[model samples]
Target: MNSSIFTPVSPTINTSLKPHQNPLILIDNKRVACARARKHVTRTKALFSTTKEIVLKEFHQRRALKIISGLQNLDKYDVASVVIAADKGGATHVDIACDPELVKLATSLTSLPVCVSSVDPAAFPAAVEAGAVMVEIGNYDSFYDMGLTFSPEQILSLTKETKTMLPTVTLSVTVPHTLSLPDQVKLAQQLEQEGVDIIQTEGGKFSNPSKAGVLGLIEKASPTLAAAYSISRAVNIYVMCSSGLSSVTAPMAITAGASGVGVGSAVNKLNDVVAMIAQVKSIAESLNLSTIEEVVFEESNLRL
Candidate 1:
């Protein structure tokens, strides 16, 4: 073995350095900083679970399905039905109102990862402690009906505060559809810079579709799809296109560049759990078919 392989080279001495500016000490400090960085990364990775791994894998494959039971929904029976439907219908995870009891109920009902949603940063810790592996900072559909809108600055502030509260928990922040598409993209970029793991898009309630059937479904999903397309391209993080999505438009969401889709009313509005499960299954199948079709097209291109 070469002696150089085991030897440490002395850094060049700088004559401009003050007495306190020791080069060796600076090198040691750098090593310490690097070690601290590695430790942070390790700690962050340690937060992942087998369920989270599966959900993330689905996102990477652009087939992730998240069933949302609604952020304001406090009805235990309704939330429980949604959670069960999400699991039986093959959804990657289920998102419910951020309550410790709801989190516990969701986790107990299914093997899928449970994500809690709330606007309150302080409420997340308790839900995470109760069993929610992921936390979402906004699910503002109900708020929209109440004439509340979150500005981009407000969202960025919320993201910062949420991160401070749960630095290691996987965070997904919604880019409010109230903003113009350009503003949405800008906010998503800022959220990504804040270390947010996922960016969710919403606009279902704002849309007013004139036509019925498939045309109406496409129109209803347009705002969120557009947001997904713009924001997904602007940031490296995952974009979950949500709000007003149906089986007809869930696949379209993937083509628009979302890593996943979140369905709320479409799955949660049904009175019967069986109907909820059927809706979830329909959306899930649409996403899977979309994935398969894309794969075939890519393979065909390779052959040519």
Candidate 2:
């Protein structure tokens, strides 16, 4: 068992009394009052949802590695190899496109939970029916190149409709990193209110910031990180960080407050399946170590 990886977070609160108020009365003060308010609302809804058994279970019990398969015009053999490697490499879940045949093939090849991605709400139920353990509203990264835009209202509506349509199946709604950081946070909070099981943050198309090295990495990941930080603080449900993420950047993601991280180009671009799995495992290990270290350090300081 990883002691550091799953340590519970301690809650901290600071309060001050206003001179104008009764001396005995103290008011709570925090840097992010709105976030706390949102969290309260989300917790209430989550309680209700849990009572109904609409809980979103994390598939990756140890550490999660979600292998993305089936790129544009890719062959079935290639997809099969990816699935086989994912299974052998200890992938927690596998994500495939909405193609029917590919879903069938993936399910037959790997017992790992399978997730299917599509932008249309109409495709969600069908994907679930086809044995997708989870469904995501994504591939907008590819669509953004063609001048497509996904608005907050549109995303909220899709989430509501999807939940109403498939109450049993888990739904992961992708928050477009294309939106401003505030907008991303707003949409995330709204999604939680609308009964979205998971909120996945993405950032590939809005801009490419990796060529500039460290500064590039910061620019590329900042939006998604901000969204993760804000949304995770505001909601108790899972938030999966993604887009332009590599082994180097994955740990930064956990530090920024993501429940899990998703990778595609880093793993998919590799020709060797074993290398991909190794990279994924390495990222998960690093996150566990970092988390443990932070917890230990905080405890030591408090004792001092």
Candidate 3:
């Protein structure tokens, strides 16, 4: 909650893929080009390889929902149920904590990509060996309650060290939302430079924002949303907006330019897994529409 760090303004548009610079944009295999004369022809083989091979190389295609089980003792049935809920709810991936049994069980139970969350650098390699598709450097919200703090330098160093050790595994580093927004942005840029694949923002600790009403919810989530907006713009990697998020603010995150989102308490806190999945799907649909509408409006404005 540093006032000085909130100085940067949010971007008016998502700048990940600029249309003017890359005029030949492809959508579902069809080329949408403004001028035939400006077209840069390529071999069909090259196009096919670029398209199909790229998809095949990645772990998953959709924005993911990483379910974290809050069960006291990690049980196979509980892990299985969460995975089932995630799959049925349309999650592209699931993230479990740094437990070996849960990692093995979750991987065996589902086809979706799995991620492991651990603060220890030593545990990352073992988590990867246990079949985690990605390794997250945090769940900092949990640590914040214990009066712990993570510095940008430590995050950058860990990222470099982690990448050096686990070269092939995808890495998602959480930008400690507890830090000032500028520090968050700086760390995000550093992580990107360190070759981290995904950046996630969280805002549940340091102080819990009230969840009583609309205004209260916004108050609670503004920090994470601001982090999402600033960090996503500063870095080229995917940013998963998280913490204090609900169905209402999901689209807001997308409009602010998050490539994805991760919800733990919102889903795990619920007693009914089916209802949780439905709510998560509703939020996902809202984000999908928001992204499409933004793209369409940008395309239309370009035509004008």
Top-TM-score candidate index: 1
The candidate, 1 or 3, that scores higher on lDDT is 1
Can you tell me which runs of candidate 1 are displaced by over 4 Å? 1-54, 289-304
Question: lDDT of each structure?
Answer: 0.88, 0.69, 0.70
Instruction: List, residue by residue over 131-245, the lDDT tens digit for candidate 1.
Output: 8889998899888888888898888888899989888778899988888899889889989999998999999888999999999999999999999998988899999999999
139 Cα displacement, candidate 2 (Å): 3.3
* Candidate 2 residue pairs in clash (backbone atoms < 3 Å): none
Structural similarity to truth (TM-score) of each candidate = 0.80, 0.69, 0.70
Please tell me which model should have the higher lDDT, number 2 or number 3: 3
Check candidate 3 and list the clashing pairs: none
Kindly list the per-residue Cα lDDT of model 2 for residues 234-302, writing each as its tens digit.
876678887767667766777777766777766666777677667656655555633554688999999
- At residue 39, candidate 3 shows an lDDT of 54
Best-fitting candidate, scored by lDDT: 1
Residue 62 accuracy (lDDT) in model 1: 79
**Total residue pair clashes for candidate 1:** 0
**Ranking of all predicted structures according to TM-score, beginning with the best and ending with the worst:** 1, 3, 2
